[model samples]
Target: MSESAAPGALEQVRTFLNTWWVPNDTRAPEDRLPALLADPAAWQADLPAFAFPGREDAPGMAELRAALRAALGEARPVALGPWLARHPLRAELSADPDRPPLALVPEDGTAGGTILAAVAEAVRAGQWARLKACPDCSWVFYDHSRNGSRRWCVMNPGGSESRGCGSIAKVKAYRERRRITS
Candidate 1:
């Protein structure tokens, strides 16, 4: 995994989910998947962890992205069950006794199946529940806080950059409080 990514295969899920547009971010305010679908090489470059879907699989990928976004936004894993059912995983036995016995692999070569498999693996690892969409900007992020109580995406954890929905939400709440007080 790269330095920017979450640990283990959860990074794939995080990256996939974060492809959705955020309104106030410096990045383009548009869903990135469309451009990626138009150019498979760019998609592969960005998401090297998963299989790049063929042009024919673009619709399935889009549907999967929507389903994933909805599931994360609502904090409901059940929302993904039907979409995930279309991309079943195959269990591969592991050799080491200390590790998990079976590893879930994508049943097909499409990006949707690979990401869905990653989601299943993340769920099994107890990390899927931590992946959430920021209520303020709808940006998907993995909450790595110790208590798992993080509610917004931090723009600058160490004052590195002022670009997160958390900062914007705090400002809005502060303004609202001031207005009420006045």
Candidate 2:
């Protein structure tokens, strides 16, 4: 993993959940989830590769995305408990017994076959949270924080911190106010 990459298994899962699954201005809104599941390579060119320890194919990627979409379509929150109940990653994280403590498996399926497995374990263990789609944008992300108060998409440049859709109206209000003052 790069110096700036997520530090551990949980962090790695958090990063992937938050960053990889979302659509931004560059990628069309409708293409985000499908592109990530069916053809990760399409987005790979733009993103820093995820590095775990033992690398193998992860079936969970597609399964989880499908499940998430189904839940979202139904207007239900994707809960981590139900997700892990269906898909488990324990065996994968333990692929390399000789590797260093907290050694992560690279995500490109090159290392051995442990990265996705570890991610599964983390999700099962509740180390990660079920991410909700942004109210403004349909992007999904893990709420890693304690409060679970996150609501906006990080993939968006302004994200939750800014006014987002509310900004356009705010700008119009300011312009109208200035006109009146003039």
Total residue pair clashes for candidate 2: 14
Q: Tens-digit lDDT track for model 1 on 1-182?
A: 32234667778778777778565635446688888878879888888988778766678887888888777634347877786677778898998996578888877767788888878777777777788777766767777778877777665444433356667778889999999999
RMSD of each: 3.1, 8.5
lDDT of each: 0.73, 0.43
Q: Give the lDDT of residue 173 in candidate 1.
A: 91
How do all models score by TM-score? Answer: 0.83, 0.41
Off by over 4 Å in 2: 1-28, 32-64, 69-119, 154-182
Q: Against the true structure, candidate 1 has what lDDT?
A: 0.73
lDDT by residue for model 2 (1-182), tens? 42123334544444444433334454444434344445556434433344322223344554554544444312223453554444333322345567444443324443113334545444445543444555554545455446766555442235433335335445677999999999
